[model samples]
Target: MSEFVRLDPHVIDEIVAICDTTLDELRSARRITDFLAIGHNFGDFESSKQLAAGYARKGAGTPESARERVEQFIEALTQLRDAFASGGEAFLDAQFDWTRQLQNIDIDA
Candidate 1:
């Protein structure tokens, strides 16, 4: 026999709220990456230009860059928030169904 583990709806709400707050913070922080771009020809020397180009490429030049990674994290957090909210609703519905079922039972019979 399998036992059902009950989830507290309030806790779920708290988790969702935390996710929302974290997502907001991450989104704000992601803006900082916008300034990571460096000019390809940052100096008169060839080495300086190479260094700047490398930094810019790793920072925000391509689709698979540092900024993209931060965006991925934000996307993951958004999904987590949505999942928690959905789970909370499902838990509430299940609780209501269980209560209705118990109320319908005639213990004396």
Candidate 2:
């Protein structure tokens, strides 16, 4: 087998940090999508409380703060939806930003 390449501990730590940050951003985006989907599903219900309760029951976490969770969920979904809906131009813009961040990490690494 070929010998493994080794990196310094500090360098490894930095690289791991960069990866962690990127993954966090990705997960945030996915959570937003989930919340938005849930909101959409609740649209046809006639009662707000009942709908909220349903969401609370089905969601991964208990709605300790119902209003806040709903608001955060809706907000995240809106941001993701808006970003994608801005067409190819916006898509490129978002990619450019993420790429720039990645580039910086590479430079640092």
Candidate 3:
């Protein structure tokens, strides 16, 4: 699961940009600036499950990996929170196509 536990900082920035949200709303969502804040600390299955469902209801997506699914779940939830803070799903679903493409990037370092 640790293979992809953290929300890439660039993704967070893209989330805000693609979503085109105001700073206040993003901050109001929880002032999230780190990976440990929302999803990583959720601590249990049911809690995370509910979190995933909320994300899916919003324009955010569900990733394909199960073991690392929690990371995707949390990232989407954070997006949902920020989006909901500013407006009612103001961004189009197309905004997240970049997310779907992330798996193809060359991350071998």
TM-score of each: 0.61, 0.34, 0.24
Candidate 2 versus truth, CA RMSD in Å, comes to 15.4
lDDT of 3 by residue, 1-109 (tens): 1122234556656765654444344444432323222354454799796775554433223233221343443455555546433443433442354355444433331
lDDT of 2 by residue, 1-109 (tens): 2323345557555655564555466566646635622655565656965775566554545433334344444444344334444432344445455445434432221
Clashes of each: 0, 0, 0
Candidates in order have lDDT scores of 0.65, 0.47, 0.43
Ranking by TM-score: 1, 2, 3
TM-score of 3: 0.24
Candidate structures ordered by lDDT, highest first? 1, 2, 3
Candidate 3 overall Cα lDDT vs. reference? 0.43
Which residue window of length 10 is worst by lDDT in model 3? 59-68
Q: Which stretches of candidate 2 lie over 4 Å from their true place?
A: 39-109
Instruction: State the number of backbone clashes in model 2.
Output: 0
Report the Cα lDDT for candidate 2. 0.47
How much RMSD separates candidate 3 from the native structure?
Answer: 16.5
lDDT of 1 by residue, 34-105 (tens): 666756447879888788777777677566677766676676556556655775444444544545544544
Every candidate's CA RMSD: 15.6, 15.4, 16.5
